[model samples]
Target: MHEKIFEGFCISSFILNKKLKVALTYNLKPEEENSFEYAMVSPLSKNSTTYNDTFAEWDTIETVNSIKSALELFHNVIMIEANEDAYEKFKKERPDIVFNFAECAYGISREGQIPAMLDMLRIPYTGSDPLTMMTCLDKARTKEILSYYGVPTAKFITAENLADIENHNLEYPLFIKPVGEGSGKGIFNNSFIQNKTELQQRLQQCLQTYNQPCIIEEYLPGREFTVAILGNDSETEVLPIIEINFSQLPSGILPVYSFEAKWIYDTRQNPLDIFTCPANIESSLQEKIKGIALKTYKILRCKDWSRIDIRLDSKGEPNIIEVNPLPGVLPDPSDNSCFPKAARAAGLSYEEMINKVLIAAAKRHKLI
Candidate 1:
């Protein structure tokens, strides 16, 4: 019995040193009178308010307290907000590791910006590097790379403006989305188009609303499954696949995982809306999904951790959708998201999951 337990170990230990210095980096709310005011008055209990109030908009004291709790296993964790002078601060007191969670600030690069800064500084951080982060942010670019790597993905076209769709070759029933935004931003039920006129109209709306190129892809009209990938390269592990059950979805809806379906889970109060991890799927299909996720993860050169969004086509083949380089870490038991959910399925709690990722990075540097 003891040998059976010992057999489960990987027989390798990379992290040998004591707890390393870690900086929990996050982006501060851009300093503006209106932004600051909105932060102050936002409802603290609301889920939507959590993004602004809980992380970026919260007072420094609140953020520091939160970080301390998250990094309870570490020896020292310094809280650093992403700002103009943050790089200098990082240089002066370079931490052994950086827990980068800077989503964005004031309509800037948001996700890729801080990672790029860290790349230049040569500081070790969790998550994908700058290039992968930038490519994945632009869904079009991500699909293109996946395609080049022979990964199956839905057919898509890049529409720079309304005029560009005049002679486009995309199929009917297309899904329009912002080229670089996430969290279902700029995606709504109206994004589905069945004809040329609706396509042009939605294209115009996306252009005007997002002020950026709109990506148009053929709607898969099939089940949506998300695969959560952890670790890097040979050591990588694929968590149980998550299948988004849309049974609660209203009839006639094409089942787009819209912003509301994701962020408003508790408000809807529907258990079916939640993610069913280790989704009930055939053994063959499960293997297929795992293979696709692993292929996409490697093709993108994603490191430390990442999550791949996938959808099954009419023929029941897994097609690559989008890659999330920096998945959210909302530890609120009320809002346990996918990344953490998968970690729990793997027998790791929130704190253990965080440390596991840090250890993965340390293994890469042979500095654990």
Candidate 2:
């Protein structure tokens, strides 16, 4: 079944045009001996305490190589580390297009750096543009945009210090995370705060550790789902919705899918039964989830693909949790990455999923 899917995808690619010169640009997580170097040098890593999870958002060599191999099936592929030398490399190689998933090393706008360079070079790239990338990286900014556009999102505020969190009208039991970090960085079981004291303590610790503003929002007390979106404009397709089974988590932990839940408790060795693809919800609720996900994708101007997380409010209506412009695509199914899991539920193999993104970008750029 997977073989036939890949064969059909390749035939379609040939019909569109010959194989493309595709550059797979990403930040490969450093080796163990050098991992601390990223923590020490990162401008965002301000506290003296060593943070081993500094590179949590960056891709591993296995992930990078897997993406490269997938792209290689339908295009000429090159590996380009999105680093200080990325601009020079892009200028020299000038691939026909870029498959970018670089969670850059420093700065609040780090995620936009590679896309910005690609924009300046007038090179086509997969995923959202620089403005959208930077905006979505800042949780507060993304929520603000969604709220203004009449999209349902949690009530939230940004705090750079404890004082910034004080005297807020928001109720207790709020959730918090670094404003600019993703891949569950700085998020943990303790991120769910119950009262003023916990809020203040967590805010101070997060500010010191992340050296960035923290977004504290009212905690939604209902089920959570993630929607994977593909294509553009009127033709956008929302793939199967995946519900997060917090019940699968260990006893005595918060229901939030924190860094521990994502990278610690859940692993390839002993994968948790934590996800339900094609979530067994009534048709009406499913449509509501899909509608909001698609609206959020368009409002953010996400180009080729994205994964939008949603959770039900107290009223049982879907509200946006967060938008992931460059969604993770860990190839191994055992790893349980959301985007690929959703794709497989929609009858697309891993290779088909990767090429579908490339095809969407190529069609958008009129390069096919």
Candidate 3:
């Protein structure tokens, strides 16, 4: 199985003798949302620490160190936070390229802020551009685009408030999620709305806590899988497919891969046996999954690489859950970062995953 999965896996796109100066931009957990409200209130805010929480979404110091060390092997690396001081710091130490992992401080365009900044400076970075980031951040908007392209995704409605959900008789057993948050933030067991009362309560809570509307979509009752695509649009490779098992969750917990399931239950010390690399499936189904992921990646015009979440629907067809252009790359083996896990599944080490991305960006920027 490993032999089949790693058939054509290239560890790195470029083996450069010249060391490029790369600015590694990221938002660390403690430094996230460094603002006046954050000063007065706790960094997690008055709302549920899990919902709309920037801290959880922010990368850890270990992650920054891991990426920096990995890139240093192939380039000159400098770390910078995507905070207020980021502009000045970046301007002073203007690197040739930026390996951006910043998730912004606030606003609907938050995920795209760092990318937009780099664009203004005419500096190249890895991952999708501002428009792609913003579009992908809004779950509803992404689904709309996928739907337009005839890409199968769960039918969903975006609600700015409870009133937005009042008019129509939407489907039940819907998946509720913050319209613009990522990394499983604002997702919990109760996110699966089975009835009106559940929808009303969860939607209201979502609005109040996340300060954003919730997307109520048809729930996918089949298996969950995350596929990582690496390389440019014309030469992208889909890494080994990953099947996530929710059977490890304690009794009564929804089978969905919610925030608690990701951050709380799946710890490094005793990682849950919740994943099957090179997912056990027939050859035809595997090809179908890869095709769907590649199609979604191209439609979004994703640059360099992306990890797309795909799930099976009631009729046994693959559908896109969402695309993560800047998917999490936590270095720790215990941390359940889907991208890294998939990379390892395909025989690429953590360093290989990090360097492959930098090399892809460099080649795209015509640097090497």
Best by lDDT: 2
lDDT of 3 by residue, 53-126 (tens): 45667777778889998877667889888888887887788888999989977987988988888898888898
lDDT of each: 0.72, 0.87, 0.82
* Residue 302, candidate 2: alpha-carbon lDDT: 91
Report the C-alpha lDDT of model 1 over 1-368, residue by residue, as the tens digit: 32232233322222254666888787544444455434433443566422222232223333345546656544478877777777897898888778776675544266777777787888888888878887888899999988988899989999987778888887787888888877556666687899999998888877876778989999897898888887887889998788887777666644777654554333223434456887899999999999999988888888888878899988999998889987755554445367777777777666666666776777776665
Cα RMSD (angstroms) for every candidate in the order listed: 5.4, 3.5, 4.7
Which scores greater on lDDT, model 2 or model 3? 2
TM match of model 3 to true structure: 0.90
| Tens digit per residue, CA lDDT, model 2, 17-99 | 57789999988777754643344224434673324568888877778888888888778999889889999999999999999
What is the descending TM-score order?
Answer: 2, 3, 1
Model 2 scores a C-alpha lDDT of: 0.87
Runs of candidate 2 exceeding 4 Å displacement:
1-3, 33-51
Give me the displacement of residue 349 in model 2, in angstroms: 0.9
Top-TM-score structure, candidate number? 2
